[model samples]
Each structure stands twice: as structure tokens, then as C-alpha cells.
Target: MIKVLIVDDIPETRNHLTKLLSVDSEIDVAGTAGSGEEAIRVAMELRPDVIVMDINMPGMDGVAAAEIVSQRLPTSPIIMMSVHGEAEQLRRAIAAGAREFLVKPFSADEFSTTIKRVYERELGRREQLQAITPAPSGPQEPGSAEEDHQVVAVFSPKGGAGRTTIAANLALALMSETGGRVCLVDANLQFGDVGVLLNLNPKNRSILDAIEGGEPDADLLESVVVDHSTGIRVLLAPPSPEGADLVTPTYLRKIIDLLRVTHDWVVVDLPPALTDHTLGIMDAADQIVVLSALEITTIKNVRLFLEVADQLEYDRSKLRLVINRSDTAQGIRISDVEASIRRPVDGTVVSDGRLAVLAVNRGVPFVVSHPEAALSRDITRLARTLAGEPSTSASTEKPKKGLFARR
Candidate 1:
């Protein structure tokens, strides 16, 4: 049974919640508290699987109580209840380490689902930590290679360059080409679109769970990631931007180190900026695919990124340049783009605006829906190249009924 602690200042609210939760056979009301301070004390004693606390409690608010409880019992998940759905409240709740948030006047179904998801997520995290606590042999040192795993980071210095789209498709194609041993990480912590692109529900569990769990081992990392239908394991970003601050560069490195041990290939979809977090991932990547469009501004940003890569002494051979929308009739040839960036274009994905939009909206990748389309063929060939297999030239087939074919 799932043990839940409900906290609210009002007696009626607490009783109502308890009654609503009691209808579910799987849930048990472990205890109830009238204020944030009382809730913290009760939580410490009860150690419930899930804590549902109201945000507007007198004296001590839900945010303060949540922060304390989270620090004290990192394994237990907190669900913040608020009447206001403002962004600030959501941010505060996430900052206080609440795993889930619910607005007031929610249905019984919503309440039950939130409790169960939080409970299961907490249980999984604890079990994972216990399973990987390094036996009597002691913890393994860093840089100890379990096996040879390739890490690929898909990046773009400019936003709207379709980096997330390319990254998702590349992961799918890699899975298809390599017999399904691929992991895709959404490193765009603030606003990652990988979950939306692949149609995955990124709630309750994310990369933040792994990082906040202290030290992540292979089992811990595996437990946090969600497996997609395309045979790709996804480490989704935090559900809100406030949760991103919890993930530091050091934590990301540790997560990647653990992930590389379990998967054959790790594909990271990065944010547009080269923050310390992004740099940390790039430092571990075996290959970096830089994406750019045909626009002058995008090409300029790519050139600047190339210069920075040189300054950082990155291996030029490991950095591959991909020109998205390569077939656009923007008067600027692919050769001109390469000349501007001072690097040869390793791959090019043809433009298919309608298909791309449709795929994103329908939560299906074009590579799966339109495998025969020119755009899909390009992604497939690019995947082969990244996988160290010989790839044929881009397909010349034009997708029928192409509209607004610009990246």
C-alpha cells in the first residue's frame, strides 16, 4: 500500500483530502498535519512514501517545509498543492524539491494519479540506490571503463536550427541501425523538447532525479530513464526550468559516466548556449554534430562555435558539420556555407516543412512515418556516418507535396 501524508492548515481540507484518498484501495492515510512546521515533524516520524502539502499554510509555507523534508528525506517525494497556478508558485515548489504539483479543486482521478506516480518514482529511486551501493568491494574509481561506448552530442549555437529534431531522429536511426541499444539524453535542462518530439510524458522522473540522488550508478541511471517505443532510452530534462538549477556540471559528468557504462551509444541533445553544463557534456562526447541552417546569422554563429572549439583544442575530426535544409533555394549554396564555417559539410538533411510539422505535432518522428522521404533518408545516412559505418550519398528523391520547405 502507498502511505501518504496530507498537510493543510484547514481541518475541512485535510478531512476532504483524506476522504478522497481513502476511496483508493491502494492508498493509506499515514497521518495529517495542520501547518508546515507540524507537517515536517509528522513527515520525519511517519516517513511516508508521498507528502501532499498545501502551499498557503500559516507561519511556515509549503515551500519551506518541502525544502526541509527533501533535505532530510531525499528518497521521499513531495507533491505541492496550491490554489494558484502561477508560474512563480510552480517555480517555488520545484525549487523546494517537490516532484509534482497540483492545482486546487482537482478531480479524484488526478489526485490519485499524482500520489501513485510520486510514490512509484520515490520507490524506484530508493530501490535503485540500494541496488548499486557498491557492495563490500568498494566503489569503482572514475575513468574505469566498463566497455567501449560512443557518446555523441548534437549541438547548435543558434536556436531554431532544429537541433532537437535532428537529435531525436538520429537516436531513432541509430537504434534501427545498431539493433536497439541507444540512449538519448535531453541536456537542454531549461527547455528541452526531446520528450515532446518523441511523444514521451516526462513527469515524476527525469535526469534531475538521478543527480539529486547523491551518486548515480549504472542501476540508478537505468531506473531514472524512460524507454521509448523506438527502442531508445531517454533521460528527460526537468519538468520546469527551476529544477534545472539543481543539476550542476559535475553531476552531469557523473551521470554521463554511469550512462556510458550501460548503453552502447549515448546521444545528447544540447541547448543552444555553450554554458558550463553544455561544455561538460561536450568534453565527454566522442563525436559532436554541429547543426546549422542556410541563413547568414545561423552560419555566423556556427563559425563562431567552430572558432571556440579550436580554442578549446577540440579534435576537429570529431566535430561534424551538418547543414539542415540543405536543399533550400536560398541562393546560398552548401559550398558557400562550408566556406564560411571553414569546415566541410559532413551531412545534409533536406527540408520537408509539412512532414516535419506533422511529425512533431503527432508525436511521431518522420524517420518512422516517412522512411522513404528524402529527409528521412538523410537522417539515416547521417546516423550511419556517426556510427562509424560507411554511408551512401544523400538521396536525391524529392518528397511529394513538400510545402514551406525551410528549416
Candidate 2:
């Protein structure tokens, strides 16, 4: 039987929900509370299988209390009920660790079904996480280090340069090529596309979760980071645009440091502008793959950014210039880009408009869905080159000093 706790500010509503849930033979209304504070106290005592909560309450609001309950009794899933079905309300509830949301006038059947569904989903998520996490082996021995612990930041000076897309695909490609743990961090806090590209719709888990939870560490990261099908872990950006304000440069730098400790390749999809947050990521990365396109404006921005890199005292070898959609532009070719930037093009990704569209629409990286395509091959070659593998990549850099490989 699924033991449930119904929490609502209204006594009638709490009783009504109890009666509604009592209809299901498999559900047991073990407890009910009239306020958020009482709800947390009762929830802790009962430790029910699920907690159905009203979003608004006097004193401590449901979202606030739910956050506490979620941390204390993480195994017990929460279903938030709100009279208003606004997107912001739902987002708030989800960010507070709600597993499901129900509009105020939901039917008994819908409530019961939602309760069962959330329970099942949470169980499955826990099981999958257990399988992914290795057994605890205590502290590491002296001189021990994680192999393939490298940080690569995928950055661009201007927007619409396919920086996020490249970061996503490159992360997956790195995992496929090296058989290592690759984590894709969507550092574009305001408007991140990593989750959409990877088709990951996690529940209340983002980089914000780790930052807000306090000092960043591996244990904290494992809780917030979601796993991709191809064995790549992802630390997504905030759920809402305003939530980006909470993610600071210091938090981002710490996150990157902690991530590189456990992960083989930390591929950070940096924000477009040259901000403090982006600079922090650059400071952590072993290589900075600066993505540009074959457009005149894009090339101009790339040149200007390179001068900034020099001013920051960044070694030229630490940066690699990559041209996306290399053959699409009318007049500007790779050689022109190289000449304009006054640097050798380390890598190039050819465009396939139709396939790229299909991949994005389908929410799968082209490298994973269409590995045989020319686009996928280019990404794979680039991955190997960055991984320090001796491959015949079309890199025009010197043989001895090829594009700042980590290995």
C-alpha cells in the first residue's frame, strides 16, 4: 500500500483529499496536516510513501517547507497542488523538489494515478543512480589520481555560433571515443540549450541545486547531475532565467574543480560573452576550444576575442580555433578564417542542415544518432585530437604542438 500524507491550509480541503485518496484500495491516508510546518513534522514522523501538498500556506509556504522535507526525506516524493496552474508556480514547485504537480480541481482518479506514477518514477530514478554510482571504497590512497581528468571549455564570443550544440556533441563524442566519464555543463545560465539538445527533463536538479545546497563537492554533484543514455553526466543550467542570478562565478569555478575530480572530461558549454563566470571556466579548463563560424562578423569577433586572450596572458597553445559549418559560407573559407584570425584552424565541422535539424528536433546529438554522417565523423576526429590521441585529424597546427591536447 502507498502511504500518503495530505497537507493543506484548509481543513476541508485536507479532509476532502484524504477521502478522495481513501477511495483507492492500494492507497492509505496515513496522515494529514493543516499547514506547511505541521506537514513537515508529520511527514518526518510518518515517512509516508508520498506527500500531497498545497502550494500556498500561511507562515511557511509549501515550496519552502517542501524544500526542507525533500532534503530530510528524499525518498518520499512530493506532489504539489495549486489552484493556479501558472508556469511560474509549477517551476517554483519543481525547483523546490516536487516530483509532480496537480491543478486544484484534479479528480480523485488523476490524483491517485499521479501519486502512483511519481512513486514509480522516483523508484526507477533511485535505482538507476545506484547502478551508476560505484561502491564506496573509502578515501583514495596517496598519489592516486583519476585518469582522463581533463577540463575543456567550449566557448564563443558571439551568440548563434552553435557553441552549445558543439559542446553537447563534443561531450558525447569524447565519451564514445575515450570510454571515459564525460560531463556536459550548460553554463549558459540565462538560456541553456544543453538539456533540450540532450532531451533531458530532470526533476528539480540543476547546477543551481548544487550551488544553493552549499559548498560544492562530489556527493552534492551526484545528487544534482543527471545521467545521459550514452554514459555522459550533465549538470544543467537553472530552470528559469531569473534563477541564473544565483549562480556566481565563484560557485561555477568551484563546480568545475569538483567535477574534474571525478569526471574524465568536463566539457563546459560557456556563455557567449566574456564575463567573470566564463573567465572562471577558462581558468579551470586545460584547453579552451574557441568556436567560430565562416561569417565575416563571426570572424571579426573571433579576432577581437583572441586579442583579449593575449591580454589575459593566456598562452596561444592553450586556445584552439574551431570553425563550425566550415563549407556553408559563400566567400569566406577556412583559409580566409585562418588568415583573418592570424591563427591556424585547429578543427572544422561541416554542416548538414537537414540532418542537423532532424537531430535537434529529435533531441539527439548527430554524433550519437548518425555516427556515419560526415558531421559526426568531424566531431569524433576532433574529440580524439583533444584527447591527445594521434589521429590524422585535418588540423593545420604543428606536429609537435598540436592544439593543446590534455594527454
Who wins the TM-score comparison? Answer: 2
> Which candidate number has the best lDDT?
2
How far off is residue 390 in model 1, in Å? 11
lDDT of 1 at 311: 68
> Model 1 scores what on Cα lDDT?
0.80
Off by over 4 Å in 1: 1-147, 389-407
Model 2 lDDT on a 0 to 1 scale: 0.81
RMSD of 1: 12.3
- How do all models score by TM-score? 0.61, 0.63
Clashes of each: 0, 0
Q: List the residue pairs that clash in candidate 1.
A: none
lDDT digits (tens) for residues 20-96 of candidate 2: 88879999999999888999899989999999999999998899888878765778899999999999999999877
List model 1 lDDT by residue over 1-407, tens digit each.
99899999999999999999989999999999999999989998999989999999889999988877775566668999999899999998886778999999999889999999888877776564334222322112345344446778899999888899999989888767655367899998989888789766544668878865676666767777886644567899988899898987878877876787767678899998877777777777878999998889999999988987786657787788999998884889888997887779999999999999999997778887777899999998999888764222111112212112211
- CA lDDT of every candidate: 0.80, 0.81
- Give the root-mean-square deviation of each candidate in angstroms: 12.3, 8.4
